[model samples]
Structure formats: structure tokens, C-alpha cells
Target: MRSNIDGKRLVDRIRKYYKADDFQVSDDGLSVGKDFYGLNKIKRVEVRQLGWRENAVNIVSLALVLSAATWAFVPQFGLIALALTFVIGFSCWRKYELRAEFIGTDETGDHWVAIARGCTKEEYSVFKEVERTMRNQV
Candidate 1:
């Protein structure tokens, strides 16, 4: 179930986050100090892929190691398996690019709202409405 979020409390929490070096509220709005998704500006899919891709690197390394072992531990070609795994892993990582600006709050101040880099005015207006309601509640 979804519910409305409080504004003063939200601002206070954001302040605390900024204080904790977890985030910072700037002229631009709230900036979670890092690239962490829970910091409030990234998508679930992007975050999920970031987590999964790192995991894939490890899994791929394991598989390559197993393959090398099956090949009688030939040292020369053993490095090839490792090298290819890393190359593939790096390419996959590249496709998971995230634009940090998309994760920030608006000038009107609504945290936890996710808007893409290029937003339509209509979308911004709707977000402002949500912010207005939340602020009014507090």
C-alpha cells in the first residue's frame, strides 16, 4: 500500500542525510553523496543491474576457472579464459550507465521522486502537486 510522505519530516530527514555525509541538499536539490540507489535518485532496474553485474563478474570468474581446470590447468591459455571473462564483464557494465542528475529532487523539493533527465512540463507539474500535498500535510 502507498501513502503520502510528510514534508517537514522529509526535509529534516534530508538534512540528517546530508549531515551524515550520505547526501547534500544543494541549489539543485538533494544530492545523495554517492551513487547508491537508496540515496533516492536511481531506478530499481538500474540499481538491480549494478548489483547483478558485479555479481556476474564473480560468477564468470568462477566459471572460467572451472573451464581452465578442465583443460588440465594449462597456464598459458588459463589467462585467456580470465581475460575474456573480464572483457565481457566490462562491456556489460558499460551498458548499465546511470545519469546521476536524474536521481535528484526538484527545485520545489520532493524527495524519493524519480524523474528522468528529460522531463515534460506536465510531469513536473504533477510532481509539484505531489510535493504540495506532502508539504501541506506537514
Candidate 2:
């Protein structure tokens, strides 16, 4: 478990790292970028790993490319299909990301918000730290 001071510092670092407009930590609670969740109101903080299904475009591109392999006899059509699939697949892969969600309940009802999204190691560490800090508070 991290000390309160360490947690606060971590939050500050994360806010700066993400270039969040307004992420502040206080005695009562902490604000996540734009949304603030009181300590008492927070129910859960978790990191959701994006699955293959979530990247539907990537899936479709992969399928198209694989099926296009069977159309090897059709030179022009096969080349076109492969080229299109390559472009789509590359774009989809570049945009792919995993996200961290903050789940809390208030007067209305339970709701969740994405606190962070990225595909880098540093960003992933930030997600884990945020989850740990929020979990400890709750």
C-alpha cells in the first residue's frame, strides 16, 4: 500500500503525464481529468483490457486478407484486396488502445467513465496506479 502523500504525488504525475486539464487531489476526494468523484461515492476503479472483438475493423481486415489469399488466382482482384486490407489493418492497429474505467454511484445511479486510454507501457502503469489508489480510498 502506498502512503497518502505518495498517492497524491502519483496522481499529480499522472495528471501531468496525460495532460489532463483538471485533475486534482484533495482531502475529500479526487478529480479525474474532467470528472470528480467523491471518495465516499466511488464504488470501483478498474482497468479493462480491450479484446479482439472490440477491434471489429481490425478483425474484418484480417478476415478479408486471409480470404483474399484464396483468390490468389485472380491477380488484379487479389492485389487490390490485399492493398485495401493492408491500409485498413494498419490504421486500425495504430488506433487500437486499452482503457481504464472509473465506476461510481451517485444520487442518480451507478455509472462509469473512462479515465485513461493508451497502448504504451507507461500509460498502462499509470492505469494500474490509478486503480490502486482509487481502490484503497474506497
Candidate 3:
């Protein structure tokens, strides 16, 4: 697991890499650049529950892995395959967190950004906070 310090460093790196003319930071760890929406800029924040495609792929991969494992001659390989199958199955059934995206257009072009993700209250709050901040700021 990554420590808080590591996460902080990563956030710092992203901020530095994507420096914008304007930015907003929230206590829940939400940050957005004014240019996140590109030349058009995002005028609204939308909370979207994404990941259906990933969940579907994980389910399909799990089926394939289990079938291959069942045919494997080596018992050890079967055991490893079973472990992987379980992990994939769990991920497919797990509750996924909602994702935040910026949407808007600019004179130059359209812009969008996927900000944060996690199955935690803090993560959800971050989305709400960002929306509130954007409404008030822009």
C-alpha cells in the first residue's frame, strides 16, 4: 500500500506537470486546473459512475483463466490460476466508486478531465466539493 506521503508526492507531481492559469484545491484531495476543460474550460462538474467496461473485461478474463486452469496438467498452475480467478471475480462484484469529469468548451476547443476515484466517502466528497467550488468560482 502506498503511504500518504507517497500520494502527496504524486499529487504534487501532477500539479506541477499540469500547471494551469487557475486551479482549485479541496480538503478531500480534489484539485482541478482552470485549463482542465481546455480552451473552452469546464463550466460544470459532473459526477459519473464509470467502470462498466472494465468490470465486463474482468469477468470475461476470469472465465478464460478458469477454463485454461481447469485444463492445465500441472496442479500448481491450477492453484495459481484459481487464485487469480478469485481476485478477478471479487473485483467484478465489488462496488465501484463514482468518477468525476470536467465538461465544457472553449473558443479554442473542448476540454475534459477525470479527476479522482476510490470507494470511500472522502472520494465522493471530493467530487461534491469540486462541484461546489466550481459553481462558486466560475
Candidate 4:
């Protein structure tokens, strides 16, 4: 899982898509924004999909309450509430399902800054490649 990574090349590749000044790969570790994770301290690099299922109950409850409250006040506004609920639900679902996140976990916590979002399969492959390279470097 571990392989030596060319720090310069990796940094260049990342810079092609991410123009952030705070991100850099160094001999000591990877720097993303203000966070610095040591090469040996990074325990894992992974691509994770975040979904709304974890908050489904809360969303459903909110929708029901809003709809009921509006319906009690004005019948037409209830329709508006329903429409808003659908829009919010669809947006939340799409937001999580369509993008993949690249994360690096170290002793302190997880750092997400290696890739741009809205990641497709190709982007996912790139994330995996970065993960492999980082693992090897570790």
C-alpha cells in the first residue's frame, strides 16, 4: 500500500485543479490550509460519500411540522410548504450523492483538502491514486 511519492509531481498535479496557496506536499507531511499532517502520522486516506440518510428522520419530522403548521394557518401555504420540502429534500440528496470527498485521517482528526468536489468516477480514481501514493509515502 505504501510507495514513494514524488512530492513535486504530486503537488503539480493537485495544483492543476486546486489553485489554493495553502496546500503543499513536503518531505515532512501534507499541508492543507492551516492544517499540517505528518507523513507518518497519516493513518488513512480515503474517498467517502456523504449522504442525508443519517438525518432523514430529522428532515422528515421538520417537513411534517412545517407542513402541518402552514396547513393550519392557510391551505394554500401548505402546498408551498410541501413544495419547499421537496426542493430541500432533493437538493440535500443530490448534494451528497453526486460528490465524493477525499479525506486524510491523522492522529488529531480527518483533513479534507486534497481534491476538488463534484467528483465523478474519474475524480474518484484520482483520489484513490492520491491515497495510494500517500499510503506509500507513509
Off by over 4 Å in 2: 1-24, 57-109
lDDT by residue for model 2 (43-107), tens: 67677766656566666769586657847767667766766776656544322232333343456
Most lDDT-accurate candidate: 2
Please give the lDDT score at residue 125 for candidate 1.
43
Q: What's model 1's lDDT at 18? A: 15
Q: For model 3, how does the per-residue alpha-carbon lDDT over 20-130 read when each residue is reduced to its tens digit?
A: 222454333434543233322444455555566766676768867785767576665776676677676654442323233344334645344555444445455655655
TM-score head-to-head 1 vs 2, winner: 2
lDDT of 1: 0.40
Q: lDDT value for candidate 2?
A: 0.59
lDDT of 4 by residue, 7-121 (tens): 6566446543323343466778766556666766555555555456734754677678888989999988898897788666543332111121334455655444433332245
TM-score of 1: 0.24
TM-score against native, each model: 0.24, 0.45, 0.36, 0.37
Tens-digit lDDT string for candidate 1 (29-79): 434445333323332211111355555765587657665784576766766
- Residue 43 error for model 1, in Å? 21
> Which runs in model 4 stand beyond 4 Å of their true positions?
1-24, 32-36, 49-117
Which candidate leads the pack in TM-score? 2
TM-score, predicted candidate 2 vs. hidden true structure: 0.45
